[model samples]
Target: MATQSPFPFLDDLADRVGEALQPPPWFVHEAQRRIVLLVNHVLMQEPEAQSRLARHKGSVVEAHWRHFQVRVVATPAGLLDLADPAITPDLTLTMVEPSPLALARSALQGEKPQVRIAGDVQFAAEINWLVDHVRWDLEEDLARLMGDAPAHFLAQGARGMADALRRFAGAAPGRPPAPPSGTAR
Candidate 1:
């Protein structure tokens, strides 16, 4: 017969704690992955236009397009032939002036949406860059938000940008601009 030490449980507990001390892989990527769905959900609901006063409305009904700029390159090669448009975001967050005390009270009450408190101040440029660069499966992207995906694929906005660019370039004042410098070949 063998006798075990009374300290055996302590050793098991220490080993379990050591394993738990190692960070979970999900913790590393959760925020990164969540951002895609979060941004998509927010932008999809953004309003086309808003009055200056609309910014002040705190109701869930409030929505506004955080403006995004994509550069236009005038060339004769047709709009589809254009390269990536330079993305510059110009979003100015204009929220309603709040009662400082009221805001403080709400803060204490934890009623404010986490998005606002999280400093998710809509960065239009980053979104545009992501939309342009990532060859997104739009269906998948949407589905991911709807909790339908096994994984997420980034969405591509370049197609839409190219469409818009083509319209702009066609109307630009120039002699078709010789198909841009590098693109001539």
Candidate 2:
């Protein structure tokens, strides 16, 4: 049986609103710059990730999600730098799924979104390794800003909220409910 969304009109409305609120080119450029910086910061934290990337120095990688895209080139220092549009990317990754709602659902369920990858096999393998192994310790970062106790409390609260939402969403029709938070597998 095919299921229909309870509020199909809202989906159309959202699409219109998103189209009307497209960011200006300058704002997009700045946002992309910040994203690259953040990605580099995380990559720097893992020496193995940096070394892997360094091996592909000068190779360009472009990532696309919907209408937004960012191209980066591997640096000799095992870091990434925003790439000029003139440079042809050695690897391109395009998100196969475009709906934000679907993407969010997948994320909450701890699954990776479908992505179409093309180009150098070695570079792709390195990227996959980084994705599978590297993660930013948000709690540690928060502790540096706000004391350890507060950071720990905040993380716990966030985790609880996330778990609650996951449970609620997964309990809906056609979805399997998630295991209760903190329960033994």
Candidate 3:
């Protein structure tokens, strides 16, 4: 027999709470601004990435996931700015998987969710290259804020935690078995 959840009404309660606590329009705008700032911070680290983006300056890329959507255009400085609503997007990328939990799981596993791409093929290629190549050097950023040694230690600890979580997630219900040790079965 299958075990039932201890709180059967929790899902309904969560839905109600989520609807009631919808973020204000200003909050959404601020959040998007912060996201753009963070993306630019990462982009600034790699000159080549900036150069590639500069080629696509003014081209709008719209990304949609669930109810959230953001459109960004490359600036002359090779950084991203919010796209004008009146402008048509050059490319659109839609997240195929809608569930936040599934997306988080894929991220923790160092995988990307399937995305449906539409519009300019060359622009899409550039975006794909950016996704594959651009990565935030969190440890380096932390070192700038704190000392190098402390930042290294924190980064090491974070990696260990991530590994442990990955192992745990892999061993979850309905997951496939871990690979066998080198010996013949």
| TM-score of every prediction relative to native | 0.19, 0.86, 0.84
Cα deviation at 31, candidate 2, in Å, is 0.2
**In angstroms, how far off is 13's CA in candidate 1?**
78
What is each predicted model's overall lDDT from 0 to 1?
0.35, 0.84, 0.83
lDDT of 2 by residue, 13-59 (tens): 76778788999989988998898888888988899999999999999
Best-to-worst order by lDDT is 2, 3, 1
lDDT per residue (tens digit) for residues 93-151 in model 1: 22232233333333443344112111223433333333444343555656657655433
Tens-place lDDT per residue, model 3, 7-105, is 447645655666788889889888999999999999999999899999989999999976678999999888999888789999999998655555666
User: At residue 109, what lDDT does model 2 achieve?
Assistant: 70
Q: Which regions of candidate 2 are displaced past 4 Å?
A: 1-11, 174-179, 182-185
Candidate 3 has a TM-score of 0.84
For candidate 1, give the lDDT of residue 134. Answer: 38
Candidate 1 achieves a global lDDT of 0.35
Measured by lDDT, the strongest candidate is 2
Residue-level lDDT for 126 in candidate 3? 87
TM match of model 2 to true structure: 0.86
Between candidates 1 and 3, name the one with more favorable lDDT: 3
